[model samples]
Every structure is written in C-alpha cells, then in structure tokens.
Target chain A: MELQAIGVQHPAVRQVQHIQNNTAPNRYKLFVAEGLWAHNMLLEANAPIDTFFWCPEAIYADEAHRRAEEIAARAERSFRVSLRTMEKMSERDKPDGLLSLAALPRWEPSDLRFGRTSLVLVADGVEIPGNLGTLIRSLDACGADCLVLTNRKTRLTHPKVIRASQGTILTVPTVEFEETGEAIAWLDRLRFTVLLADTDEAVNYRQADYSGRTALVVGSERYGIGKEWYGHGYQRVAVPMLGSGDSLNVSVSASVLLYEAKARKANW
Target chain B: MELQAIGVQHPAVRQVQHIQNNTAPNRYKLFVAEGLWAHNMLLEANAPIDTFFWCPEAIYADEAHRRAEEIAARAERSFRVSLRTMEKMSERDKPDGLLSLAALPRWEPSDLRFGRTSLVLVADGVEIPGNLGTLIRSLDACGADCLVLTNRKTRLTHPKVIRASQGTILTVPTVEFEETGEAIAWLDRLRFTVLLADTDEAVNYRQADYSGRTALVVGSERYGIGKEWYGHGYQRVAVPMLGSGDSLNVSVSASVLLYEAKARKANW
Candidate 1:
C-alpha cells in the first residue's frame, strides 16, 4: 500500500504515462483516476489497487470521506500525499486530490456464461475506446452474453474505455479474435443464430428470432461488417428504423437489439 | 455555399464553451445537431447537414467512402474537409471526416400521437448529453411513442447529443417540459398508464402489463427522479438487472424498458 502520486509530470509519476495512453497495446496494471466517483468504483470493485494517495485539497462528498477512510484502512498500504504531487500526475485540466491505482480484474469469454442465453452481442471494427466501453455497459445492462470483439477494434485495456464503460467492463467478459469469420464460425458451431446488422438487410430485427442462443453482430459505424464476412452463415437483420435517419449509434443499435432479445426470451 | 475554415485556432468556437451556461441560452438558435446518428444518424435521416468530414487516416473499406459520399450528396450542402478539421471536431483521435452540423429540429409533444397509445418514453432530469442522445436513438429503434424532455438536463440543441440520437431526434416529435410532473399529469388525464422507473421499485420491469396505453418515465442517472414527486398514479417499475453491481446506465436501462414494453405488446 505504498502511497505515490502517479502523474505524467514527475519522472516517477510520468513513468506510468505509457499506461495512461489509450493507444497503448497493453493494459495498465494500475489506473490513476482524479475524481472521487472513479476512485470509489475501483475500491468497490475490490480491484486490487496497489496504492493510492489522498490529496488534502481533494473535494470530498458526505459519503466520500467515510468511504475513503474505509478503503484506506483495507489497503495493504496507503498514502497521504500532497495536492502538488497529484497535480504532477493529473492528466486532465482538473486534478483532484484523491488518486488511486486499482488492480484491474482479469476476465475471459467463458466467464460470461448466461443461463439460457438469449441474444448476445458481438462487435467488430469498433475502434473507439468510449464507444466500446458504452457498448460493454449496454451489453451488461441488457443481459447479453459476452461481447465478442475483434483485434481490429480498440482493445479494452485502455483507461478511457473502462471509464466510459462506467466500470462495467470489469464485469463483462469478452471474446476477442484476429479472425472475425472464425468467431462467426464458432458461434455457428454452437448452433447460435448469427445475425448481422446492416441497412440493406432483408429481415428487420424484430422479425429475426432472438429467442435462442444468438449472436448479434454490429460493425464499426465507419465500416460495417463487410460482404466478405456478411455472406457467411450470418443473416443480415436490421432494426426497423422508421425515421428519416437509417441507423442508430453503434452502441445504441446494439442495445435495442439486446433489449428485444432479452425482452422476448424473458417475456418481459 | 460559402465555406469557412473557422480554424480551431479561431477564438469563436470556445467563446462561450458551454452553450447550456445560462448566459448562452441563445446558442440554441445557432447551429445545433437535432437527431440521433447526429453524425451517423443524420446520414440515414438525410438531415440537412452543412458538411461532411472524416479522418482520411483510418483504414477502412470502400464502403466507408461510399456511405460518406452518399450522405454528403444528401446534405443541404456538402464538402470534404481534411483530417485536421475532423480531428478538431471529433472526440476520437482518429478522425473519419464524418463530422457534420445542422440546425436543430423543433418538437411538440402532441406529435407523438400513436395507435391506441400503448407505449411511450418520457425522460425527465436526463442531464447527460450523450445519455439523452442515446435515449433518443434507442427510442427510435425501439419505436417508442415520442420522447419527452424536461428542463432537468442538457439542452437538446447540443450537437453531441443529436449525433448520439442517430437522427431519431429528427424523426421523433419530442416535447420539452419545464416541469416533468405537470407533463405526467397531462398524460394521466389522457388516460395513459404512467410508469415511473425507480431503483427501489418492487415490481420487476418484466412483470408490467405493457399492453395498454403506457408511459415510461426515467430520471437522470446522477440524481434519479428525486423522491419528492411520486405515487400520483405513476406506477413505479424496475428492470431486473442480473448483474450485482450498480443499476444499468440510465440510457441502457431506459432502452431495456422501452423494448420490453415493445415486446410484451408485440406478444413475442
């Protein structure tokens, strides 16, 4: 529980700057957040944050101080650092006093098993960290199976994605693949219906059966799941968008589909 | 069309950074993104956008270009800008030159009149811009009857929220309310079965009878519809979030409930 302010300024704090970069290929073993909510999320998640420093100047809500004290007590070690050190590592314009690096929870696809899987979501070519995080959060909310990802998309190792996920990324297991076709095939082998979302689909999403193990595939908003993969066993299913606009944000679209699937199967 | 670079270096953009900042209330009269897919949705909606831009750097198939050009052709006026401009406007570091701007659309609550008024979505205290946008996008996808917005949240004129709505905001005749409780009373007088989303509600969302005229009410995530106003014939309902953590993000939870209503009524 050693206390150290990890910022991008000081050589000691700046050392973790590489981890802070969203573009980095590997996940940061430690994540330093500037806000009270994020730090609390990590603490509540029991994420093994090795160390954290509470700044004297950091604002505390009514519950925040009590929670911080409890988190500090539980920390194998803790630090009471100065606001100056936090400023050195503060990535944003506003750097709060409480900075902590919680250990990220490890996950795998098998960990996402659901009872009688209805409509699970699969994402490919979603390269934006925030979009991916939002997608994961939606998947978790809609009770979809693991969000299968492709290497071509942004990996969840990024801190922004975790923040955007609002901490749900820690809960949602993912299945990533170099070959999306293989991923599709794997879903096919499992007898799960593969439904690809596109504008030109012959079947509307409502018409598609999501009452069983299903893989709803959504592509990057920029580039949809291309015909190369589209012609596979997948059935192109489009949501019935009656508006002038033809599509939803990738994550929102996925949410609609997931809600439909869960609703039907659950008879909600 | 007269094209203006209006460099990011230009001071005008940041003059009054937050349009919602009370002094800047007039900002709504200026350029505003009005629909879901405000960026992506506008294309589907053929919403009148000033231009189209994307980061020329991201790797994508020809479909991306084809779609971009298609959308541009449909815009009120269109042009191709550079990755630099795209980067400045887009949050994602990798610009897709898909940036666009359009005048916000106007709305009236009466426009949401539907068949037997079986289901509808009413959002109050929905302060988060992206959540509002995402909700609009989902409302369109889930085919909810009109989206209602009250004064408790971000201004609908914000471009980011419109972009998130994916053009649904453009299609849906959303009504604005200064007071949500008053609006609920109006719907109540109309005989709509009002359902309030509560984190502590005992009735599971799936158990609700969505077959009749139903109004789905949701509060802001940060401060859920304050407890002060409740129990006035507004049946409180809750979504069964399988995960043990915090409740679903507001937008996700709303989408789930909306689609569940869609499903039960669909008799799926």
Candidate 2:
C-alpha cells in the first residue's frame, strides 16, 4: 500500500489538531486516539478508524510497528508523516508515532438494553475528564451495561478520557442527558433500583442490595449529586471512611461501590 | 500581626518556586501545599507549616480568608504576596491565593506500630505522582496503618501527590525501602499476611483472608510487582475483570482490595 506523505499543515492533520485542541466547533463529533495502547485496543474492539497517521521513525517497538501496519491495512485513509509532524499531532510529551481519528459513537437512552441483571452507572456533573474516563474504566471492569451522564461537564471524546479509559470508552455504551430529570425518568421506566453514593448516608455500600437491575449514581468531587436526585425513592449508600479523611476520591468511591455490586450480583 | 509583603523575586518566593518546579536539589525536604482543601487539611492534621504565603486579592471564598488568618497564626513564617506572584509560584492554572511549605514527614520501619488488625499497603515502583497520592488517599480511607514503598519511583512530597492525597500524605506514616529484601524482612518479622495484587493470579481478592495484620502490595501500571516480591510466601490475589479492560487503574485496584480487607477485617 502506497501511503501518502503529509506535512504538519496538511488539511487532515490540521483537522486532527483542531479536534485535539478542542478548537474545532464540532470537536465532539470526532475524537483522536493516540499511541500503541489505544491503537491496539481500537483494533481489538474492531472499531472503525476513519484515518490513520503513522511516523516510521517514531515507532521504536516491534509490536508498535506491527500494529501500525495492521492499522494501515484497516484504516479507510492512511498517511505517512515525519516524526516532527507526529509530535505536533500528539498530546503527550513523547509521541508513540501512531494516531487515529474516529467518529464519536453516538448512543441514546433507547439504544441501551436492560435485562434482569443489568448494571448501569449514572455520573452526574463529573467535571474532570480524567475522572470521567476512570469512571468508565471502573464501570467496564465491573461489567456494567451502560453509562448515563447527567450534566456532563467533559466531552466523552476528550483525549484524556480516551487515554485514561485505556480505550474502554469505545466498548462501553454511554448516553448523555442534558437534564437530570430525563435520566431519572429513563431509569424509573426501566424499573432500575437507583443507588446514590452519599457521604452523609448511614447505609453502608456493601449493605445495599445490588442484585437485579441496578443503577449507581456518583457526583462531582466539589459539589456532590444534585439535590433533585434526592427524594426520588433512590437509596443512599456510603463507603465507610474510617480514617481522618472525610471522603474517598469520586472515582475510587464509584469503583468500590461497583465492585461491591459486582460481588453481590455474582454471589461471590 | 503585620504581614510581611513580598515581591515575585523575593528570596522566600524564589525558594518556593524552586521547590514547586522541582529545580532545587533538596526539593524532597519540603513540599508545597496549595488551595483550600490542602490548607484546611494541613491545619486539621496539625502538621507544622514552615511557611505560609497568601494573596488576599486572589482569595474569593470567605472560608479561605478565615483559614488564611488561622494559617498565619500557626505558620512559622507568613508572607503576603500579590496575586501575580502567587500565580507564578502555583502549579495549577488557577491559584487559590494560599500556599504553604512544610517539612516532609519521614518515617522508618520502626516508626510504624502494627496492631493485631493492622492494614498496611505496600506500593512498588509506582511511577506516577498522582497515582501514588491517590494510593495514599485510598489507604487512608480504608484506615490502613501505614504505607510502605519499595522501589519507589515518584517522591511522596511531589505537589501532585500532596494534592491528590488531599493532604493525607501528611498524616499517613510512610516509609520507603530502597531494597525489596529489607521491606520483606520487616514484614516477615512483624508477621504480616502479605497479599500481592497480580493480574495472572487465580485467587480472587475477596476469597483471600485479610484478617489480622495485613499488607496489600500493588505495583506500577506499566510493570507488575518486582521479581523479588514473588516466591516469598506472599499470597497473590486478583481482582476479577468481568469486562473488556484487562486491568483496573493501579489506585483503583488498591482501593478495591483495601476496602475488601477493611470490610473482611471488620466482619461487615
């Protein structure tokens, strides 16, 4: 395959840079996945790659070079670029020489399927991209079905989210609701047992029933779950903080709760 | 009390910048704590503050101002600086008008007192500062007795660690061993049931006994635990990955295992 050589200022390269910088108005429509881990995961998941860019000089690892060839074969459009151009396109200090652009997977409430043993995660007002990504990774690790973001502060396509998620964001089904009410309505309609993680709550997380259809809700670090989330028949659960620190990190709390749910559901 | 006014180039200010930038040779001797949470936690722990620097104009919250006065009263030396100077010295884009320098607490194996039901965490070769800090925070939340670092990569006093730990690093008794053998010898003498988090292990974490004196060992994300850590009678435990992700974030894995130990020890 003859790969077209491109420079830093190439139209496609500029488009990728714009999307990465979040300077492009429709940035959320497409996302950039960089380096070896993301590339390998993308291939593992069989996700469609719109375009692939690789720097022969920058790819030092044998596995990376092999993956680059695989990506080039599968990508709709593939291009070769200099190491300098690759560095300019990469967000990390050290570029791994492979980058790809893919359309953001759009999911809706209707798209999510709930079964008798469904486990859903609702993250409300999570401001940090890295935290949101970590939440997705945890949700995935616990075998959760879907993620519903209410008052979502960061784009799911944000590079940090993709990187921190280790590309699990591509596998997990996620939807966003601008209003918390809409999300609540959907969960209610699905007959999901909603569990809100509250620091003040008396019921310990392990004590909560997680069998059957369950939805775990976690909020931002600074301002917790919205007040509207309360008085909605949702059970409040707390991870016991036995030390001087008042609360665990938001993602840490979510993972603990999710794992508890996982163990209970599995009867482990 | 008359507050000493300082310029950006003031000796104390330069010293802080040097420490924050990790440019000073003795950067590990003193750590910088910034923003409201760090300030409040530092005071709550009664950790000695070597110096406090405040920017009145940059402080927007009423509680911050109140805390400023309290910090000034307790700090060995206090200075008032312009917001520009504060921003220059701060690591975050938004400076919170409060910063402090404190001597890093040093602990030895002898300093740690293990009880019958002690929970100690051993983090090996954790390269990321934020991840290390998060590990400390999770260890604190689980009410762990102390943190033992073997083949430690990042400095515990790094600003990212301090911020991510929410100042729990200041309170947690942490000792680092350059050699894994020394750490193993100490744990053996203390009769701690060592549990290493391994991806290849078949023993599920929850099935493992965490009662009595316990130590949970987690390794760097890139590299698993050191080779010397194996064949030492330290039982290997694994968190079941029910989804596509091969492993959870190192901190997340540590927290889940720590909480599991916490619950099992308490018989919850």
Using Cα atoms, each model's DockQ against the true complex is 0.37, 0.80
Which numbered prediction scores highest in DockQ against the true structure? 2
Show how many residue pairs clash in every candidate, following the order shown: 29, 0
How far does residue B167 in candidate 2 sit from its true spot (Å)? 1.6
| Model 1 misplaced stretches (Cα beyond 4 Å) | A1-12, A23-30, A59-80, A108-119, A142-145, A188-191, A202-207, A210-212, A226-228, A263-268, B1-22, B32-103, B108-115, B263-268
A33-95: candidate 2 lDDT, tens digit per residue: 888878888898888888999888887888988898999989899999998998888888988
TM-score of chain B taken alone, candidate 2: 0.93
lDDT of each: 0.66, 0.88
The share of true interface contacts that also appear in candidate 1 amounts to 0.49
- Per-residue CA lDDT of model 1 for B1-268, tens digit only, reads 2244454454433322333233454533334332123455555555566544433354255666556666556665544445564445555545453555554666566655567846777887888788888888778766777887764667776666755765566776677777766786668777888788886755888787776788888887777875545767567888766653566677877877787787667754
Q: What is the DockQ of candidate 2?
A: 0.80
Best-matching candidate per TM-score: 2
Tens-digit per-residue lDDT, A49-110, candidate 1: 66556765675575666666766775655666566666665676777766665656665555
Look at candidate 1 and tell me the lDDT of residue A6. 41
lDDT of 2 at B209: 90
Q: Model 1, B251: alpha-carbon shift in Å?
A: 2.0
Per-residue lDDT over B127-244 for candidate 2, one digit per residue giving the tens place of the 0 to 100 score: 9888898989998888889999999888877888988898788788898898999999999899999999996855988789987899899998899899999997778999899889
